[model samples]
Target: MSIKRILPLLVVVLAGLGALSSGPLTAQERPGPLRIVIDEGVIEPLPFAVPDFIAENGAAREYAARITRIVAADLQGTGLFREIPKEAFISSVTSFDAPVQFGDWKAINAQALITGAVSVSGRRLTVKFRLYDVFSGAPLGKGLQFAGTTASWRRMGHKVADAVYSRITGEGPYFDSRVAFIAESGPKNARVKRLAIMDYDGANVQYLTDGRALVLAPRFSPAGDRLLYTSYESGFPRVYLLDLGSLRRRALDEQPGTMSFAPRFSPDGRTVLLSLSVGGNTDIYSLDLATGKRRRLTSAPSIEIAPSFSPDGRQIVFTSDRSGSSQLYIMPAGGGEPRRISRGKGRYNTPVWSPRGDLIAFTKQNKGRFHIGVMQIDGTEERLLTSSFLDEGPTWAPNGRVIMFTRETAGAGGTSALYTVDTSGRNLRRVPMQGAASDPAWSPLLK
Candidate 1:
């Protein structure tokens, strides 16, 4: 019996949460701590306030306001926290060491209050911040300070926001990371593509590769210092590994007449998983980078692609049509019998295992519509988070709380854009960018 024909059946069930619209919540509506429960029903976003950061020195005045604004934008953009406008403040904070007027903030319904100070010396910058519970009149945690070069002001701002987010949500921070994607220009048919990297918020964009070759799926290594992408530079799709620090790259798993694509690094960064086609058949393979050895993980006749390693590196989730339709499957990382995990009435592709190891995010096409959905590891609790003309390439944030993907309209004037949504299927928003872009792969939080 063929390996593909003997796999156990794990039926997929189509289920989604009903849309619930929530009005702006008052402080009284959410009277408990600012903890977000993803499994619970939709709740109103928490309200918070951030006044201008106090300048500790004459040279730091310009940075103080900019840093404060960036931090506020980061929190508000998540749809989990609403920023109270400065016009609603009844008291002003001028000193970093001054006690917060909790009563004034409470009067304005600010549940959380952020205060900070910025200092600059030569090219050095330092920022300190404190989070306070306005209702309880107590600090959320000990004050913290971060020091770095002045040129990295935005990163410093992200770090502060990460600290506050971690303290409040009890999840790891994603703001202090980067995203690698395909930066595109020109017409949709003859578009030029280049490998690009940018901050998580889509700022500080830097092109790593010129538009000389067609590159796709720039997957960041676990260490966040290398990239694995498919390039048609050799006139066929081949996987290449690029050293992010030196801007140098080399092809991998090159054979006489084989084509390889869909490359991703294993959790330990020691091995690579990719799809290799030979004699019109494609199967997943793993390569040890250090030894130049390869192992075929699947021996099925059906085309298999988009292999993603689980967090523990013990298993993998990928897409296959062995079941007569494209669906998701899970198997041992080293290769074994596979089991279907996608049970819906549609085609599921580009299955990405969540960083939290609890969910699998994928792109589904059904009823002439494209959707991004999440399901439990065992193929249950499927929830479609988004639907559009074209939505593909789902990537997760470092914390696994949000997902970023590619969305394109269906027309001659359609252009590709990046977007994000909370794991709870809420807070869908577009990512700001300069032009057409797609194929995003988020990196681990920067050290």
Candidate 2:
């Protein structure tokens, strides 16, 4: 079937599945066949099972197994679903169309079941899957099929996993996204930093710049086709925009005696917000990409940096030391009187507005400890998600349910690495990287 036909079919199937519950529910009061309640307290991950996808032909056998494993890994990585080992299965899923042995799955306490099939024709690949509510002995949603090139098998797996995750949790999909970061090498004093991009799970690492120059704070454009970062190639910190397709870059706001850094793209991707330092003063300015015009957003003597636009482009959240200590503040998008949003004791920096627009994630340093935290847009209900020797530069996932940040160890030999945690502060784990990495910025879900 053509992709045009496949998408509409998938949408119709998903719609027919019915609306999902949005609030937390007790096990006894859970309204759906399967649900994951994200609460303040500890949560027991729902048990799930995904047998190897049935290969429709001999050529598809290997692809089927790989895709199945990827799907399971994606679900388990969320800390919301625990996969039941294949060895524990009482009955095997031998066919894609076979009715699931609900009693067999329930016996193992598998709350959710996933069945799939894979087929290959030359360079074309197709994946089909069904999610079941084991206890209810019914399909949670109609079966869905995805078609793509064989080289994109990994994405096919991610799409299936995204569908399963969203259906069970009532959250958006995030599995099929990319992350831009500063890949590091050499010793701490003279470390080499290069621009790099990778899959959300740190797969397919591709270096975008040579390590000859220092790079920091890679921010993805709204369309995910370009990046805004700071580079020291010209012997001074300056903002540079890099195009991913052409691998070309150009410095922005290149004034005679001014240095610019800490750049971020506005939600619409037409304007760039950056901190430009002239003489002894630093302020925030918005640069129009098309006309190369600069508009100052803050005219304060106190330093203001790390500005991020709200999803709707109506407001901006940034860090300023105007309160004597670094704290987060919000101002109108077009520059106006600022409102202090962070009332916490510690210093706050690198405030990133969540894509959902309900929360802002930031790095906080207090006493001798550093932390990554999130709070309501108004800065209420501040909750720290992580604390370490040096944790800074938080970036939100596309769905805003997770935050990825740079965490450095201590001492001279301390190395930086990337870590992710849910907004609830659960499932803290390091992303797999060959060497030290930091300053991660997640891209939006890929089209």
- TM-score of every candidate relative to the true structure: 0.92, 0.92
**Candidate 1 colliding pairs:** 12-343
Q: Candidate 2 regions off by >4 Å? A: 1-30
196 Cα displacement, candidate 2 (Å): 0.6
The worst-scoring run of ten residues by lDDT in candidate 1 lies at 8-17
Residues 352-426 of candidate 1 have per-residue lDDT tens digits of 999999999999999999999999999999999999999999999999989999998788777889999988888
Clashing pairs in 2: none
**Cα shift from native, residue 57, model 1 (Å):** 0.9
Error of 2 at 422 (Å): 0.9
Off by over 4 Å in 1: 1-32
Scored by lDDT, model 2 comes in at: 0.87
Instruction: For candidate 2, write residues 193-216 as lDDT tens digits.
Output: 999988888877888889888888
Q: Each prediction's Cα lDDT score?
A: 0.86, 0.87
